[model samples]
Target: MNLSPAERRAGITVAIFCIAAAALAFGLTLPLLGLLMERDGWSRSAIGLSSAMAPLAILMVSQFMPRLVARFGAKRVILIAALSDAVLLILLKITDDYYLWLPIRFLMGIAISALFVTSESWINEVTENHNRGRVMAIYNIMLSAGFASGPLILVVVGIEGWAPFAAGAIVMMLASLPMIFAKVADPPFEGTASFSVWRYFLVAPTLAGAMLLFAIVENGSTSLLAVYGVRNGLPEGEAVTLISAVVFGGMVMALPVGWLADRMDRIRLLVMLAFMTTAMAILIPWTIADPVWRLVVLFAWGAAASSIYTVAMALQGERFKGADLVTANAAFGTIYGIGSLAGPLVIGGAMDYDDPHGFAWTIIIICAGFLVFTVIRQSMKRG
Candidate 1:
């Protein structure tokens, strides 16, 4: 555990770049897949189903990730993930059939999940407690900024031909090259006893709940925001930018939230974030047609909602380390995948409503569910 200052900086740098790369692939792929399918006459339901495959893969694969990392090392896992991610992006162009997309998307999910688990575990390993909040905040910002940049790239490439797919594959490969040169220490898995994921859940149910809720809200929002915007009469270009607006909020606002996390009560901050996010979701329906106001609300929505994950993960790093940290993050990825699996379906089903604002309502309901859980969790802790 004794890392010199130079090693620490290098490790931190590698982890950040790895995470940013993984995140960029996710940001680029998710919307592009949905939009392309829609353009080819796929139903909202079918498109939503296709999107769910990735999360399903994560939920199934994440349980074994800790062991895989132990056996293979995080750096190796990351390299494989990046390489596989590139291959998967290229594979998407081989077919236009939704059924064919299901398995491809599932493989895509596994690649991204591996990168997610390895990168996060690596980052948590290198970061110290004294500045964990700020570190994670920076991590979250980079991740969000990567996510925001995807739509902007999509704007240039357009969702038409092989160009977007090639771009995605190329960037993923480029992300792997930097890590090939850095020597990241292997995780402490040799003497560590394998812990049940449920044990981690029991130790930190509130944080676990936060991860699940964040996944549901985050995926649901990013996936459908453009569709919702278009349904509400915004141009396709404007609708797509709404996602970037939200991500931009997360990119800029996460730092302040992280600074506050270091200084304030984290549980209380989480509650406040949930409350603010819910309020923003409710306002989306009202602001749907007002482009300027909608952008403003989406920005704030992104800031609050994304900070929940940032702050919660900082809390995890504060409390857990080594094998336990791996288990905790694996648990998080599994739960996040579960929520991600459901988010689009729930939102897509809600969009079936005659009201164009149903997408916002779906988000509100999910946020309310999280808010209620946090309140009850707080009450129980006090009792």
Candidate 2:
């Protein structure tokens, strides 16, 4: 398991590239699909359900990912998943029926979950605990940058034809090239057959909670932010740009937050982030009329909300190792899948009920709930 520093850096770089590529594709696809569906007269609820399919697929498949990687090896599994994603993106471009899209999106979700679970576990496996916070921060920074680039690309391409889909598929295929020639061996899986992924939630309830909260917020915002912007009177181009603004905030602030995670009590850091996120959500309804202020609020909001996952992942690496670590990561993906499924459903429903402002209110409520739960969890532990 001991790798020279250069070897470790190479491993980390390849893994990050793979995951970030997937993020880029997802970032492009989610909003692109949402805007397309909206243009075709799909209901908000129906669009939410369609958006939920990927995470639903993630929830169904994530628990098995560690075992799949163990059997197939990380590089092979990632290669296959990346290929599958490219093919699925092409299928989405060909199909015009919403019913068909349900299954296509679900299948794409499975591929994405595999990419996430395998790459994340691989990165943690190669990292030393002492520097995990900083490394994961850099990991997330790349991830957020990938996400930000997606919406920016969409703004340029205009989501009119096959161009956006073709662009996404090309990125998916290209991202896998690094893995095809990677020299490092896959990390050994030492988890026993009897180990349950759910047990990790009991072992690290706060980490589990943080991940779920993050999933709900991240998926909800990314999938629906464009829709929200349009409903509130922004042009389609401007609406899509809002997504980039949010992700750009996360990209800008991840390093500082990561640095803080390494030096502070992480639980306290999570609390502060939760508070910041809730406050930003409160300001959104007020700021929507002002473009510059809206971006500023969302940028700060994205920074705080996104850091929750960075700190939580760093904590998971600090707390577990080997087979257990892989299993814990699978559990993390599972919880994220669950949150992803619920986020769009709930937030979309709220928006359907109340229009544009519901989006802001739903985020506020979710962040507040997590903030309360985290505070109580900390208090009980101290007692």
Q: Model-by-model lDDT, in order?
A: 0.84, 0.87
Off by over 4 Å in 2: 32-46, 93-97, 151-164, 193-195, 225-242, 286-293, 352-356
User: What C-alpha RMSD separates each model from the true structure?
Assistant: 2.7, 2.9
lDDT of 1 at 311: 90
Candidate 2, poorest ten consecutive residues by summed lDDT:
187-196
Tens digits of lDDT, candidate 1, 91-198? 889876778889998998888888888788888788877677788999998887777677667889988889888888988998898789767665554457356676
Estimated TM-score per prediction? 0.89, 0.88
Clashes found in each candidate (C-alpha, N, C closer than 3 A): 0, 0
Candidate 1 ranges with C-alpha deviation above 4 Å: 31-46, 94-100, 154-163, 189-194, 230-238, 289-291
What would the TM-score be for candidate 2 when compared with the true structure?
0.88
* Cα distance off (Å), candidate 2, residue 378: 2.1
Q: Which prediction has the highest TM-score against the true structure?
A: 1
